[model samples]
Target: MGLLDNLKAKLNPAKDKVSGLAQQHGDKIQHGLDKAAKVVDEKTKGKYSDKIQTGTGKAKGAMDRLAHKDGTDAGGATDTPPAPPPPSSPPPAS
Candidate 1:
């Protein structure tokens, strides 16, 4: 096996364990993220409020993805389909 493949195989178990833990404690993890963001925002006196907010959002999204809350397929890409756009009017009868 390739070096990367071997490394991935060895890490799979730990990754699974962490994924399970993330799913179980996602709320707590998000809370901690929020708390940390708040502290950092305060420390920066809102200088980077937008950037911090963006970063926090990205972190939470990553955590959700790791926890499989985003319905990812085996390839780790989201399997969920985008919502269909609303029709402006009913389609004309054929």
Candidate 2:
């Protein structure tokens, strides 16, 4: 195998391990992200609230994508169904 192919072969196991860890500890990772964001926001005295929010959202989106929560299966096909919307119209006035 060539240099790039050999490197990929060696890194494949590590990649799988990282994916598994990301799936297993995703919640804890997200919580840590939130806590860190809160501390930074407080330290900045809310001056960068919008930027902080945007960064936090992007981080969470990346985490979700890493965890494969975007509905794509291992085969890269979307095997999950879309989420249902919330109910509307307050029980039709009873």
Candidate 3:
């Protein structure tokens, strides 16, 4: 294999492990990101609120992609919609 191919092969396992961890801990990771953003915003006295919000959104988007929570299939298309809730049972007669 070429140097790039060899490097990719060596890193593939680590990448997979990281992806799995991201999927498992996605909620916690997102919470941490929000908390950190809040702390930074507070420290800066809201001076960079807009910038911080933008960065935080981008970070969350990246996390979702990493965790496969972005609704994208293996083909990279998001054509599938979320499943609907089951119908509720009818009320009993009086």
Candidate 4:
């Protein structure tokens, strides 16, 4: 194979692996990205808020593409997993 072809062959496996992982964990990954952006914004005191927001949006879009390979939503954007229920309080004695 030519140099370019050899390089492409070597990178193809890595690309496929990344694609598979993205399909499996895209939503969780996007959520983490959003959380990290929030933390960074807080640390910078909103100085880079606009840029952070843009990055976060792009990350989410990429996540959507990875997770939705079939061009249909796979519970990524519209269906955020529900948070755990709050703990129940003990009842008072009668």
Candidate 5:
């Protein structure tokens, strides 16, 4: 395996654990993000409100991706698993 591949393999377990945690505590994590952003915005006297909002949105998006709640795979595909085909009707007897 290449260097990047080796690194990814080593980090896979940690990544899974983090994803699980994110999924479990997503609401709490998002609340914290909003709280921090609000505080920073207030501290800056709303001068960076837009920037703060953008950053917060990006961070939330990343969290959703990590939790696989964005309905996308690693390749960014939104394709869901194919459903089973319906059973065919039997032919009439001769």
Candidate 6:
């Protein structure tokens, strides 16, 4: 098999697992998304409000796709906007 196909084969199980989890916790997941977005917006003092809102929407849409494979629209990609990486804490030493 080609490299891409081999990688896909290995990831299939993980995709399935994510889908299952999404289905089971779809509502809860969406709720968490909303909560997180609010917190992020608040922390950033709304400087990147539009981008943050758009990202949260896209993320929630992706999660919806994971939860429901019915091919329902996840809205358009036009709403997507550039986002900065999240603040990070230093990694633990090995």
After superposing candidate 6 on the true structure, give the runs of residues whose Cα lies further than 4 Å from its correct spot: 69-94
| Model 2: colliding residue pairs | none
The C-alpha stretches of model 2 lying farther than 4 A from their native spots are 1-3, 73-94
Tens digits of per-residue lDDT for model 3 on 1-94? 8999999999989988988999999889878977887777777777677777778877877777777776878787765443322222333344
RMSD of each: 12.8, 9.4, 12.4, 11.3, 18.8, 9.9
List the candidates' TM-scores in order.
0.80, 0.67, 0.74, 0.63, 0.80, 0.69
User: What does candidate 2's lDDT look like per residue over 1-94, in tens digits?
Assistant: 8999999999989877877888999889878877777777667776676677677777876666667776776676766543322122112221
Q: Each candidate: what lDDT?
A: 0.76, 0.69, 0.73, 0.65, 0.75, 0.69
Q: What ranges in model 4 sit over 4 Å off?
A: 64-94
lDDT of 4 at 12: 83
lDDT of 5 by residue, 1-94 (tens): 9999999999999999999999999999888988887777767777677777778877887887788887887688755432222222233244
Worst 10 residues of 3 by lDDT: 83-92
Number of the candidate with higher TM-score, 4 or 5: 5
> Residues 25-51, candidate 6, lDDT per residue (tens digit)?
887887787778777777776666677
Distance from true position, residue 78, model 6, in Å? 15
Kindly give the stretch of ten consecutive residues in candidate 5 with the minimal lDDT sum: 82-91
Model 6 worst lDDT window (10 residues): 82-91
Q: RMSD in angstroms, candidate 2?
A: 9.4
Off by over 4 Å in 5: 78-94
Clash totals in order: 0, 0, 0, 0, 0, 0
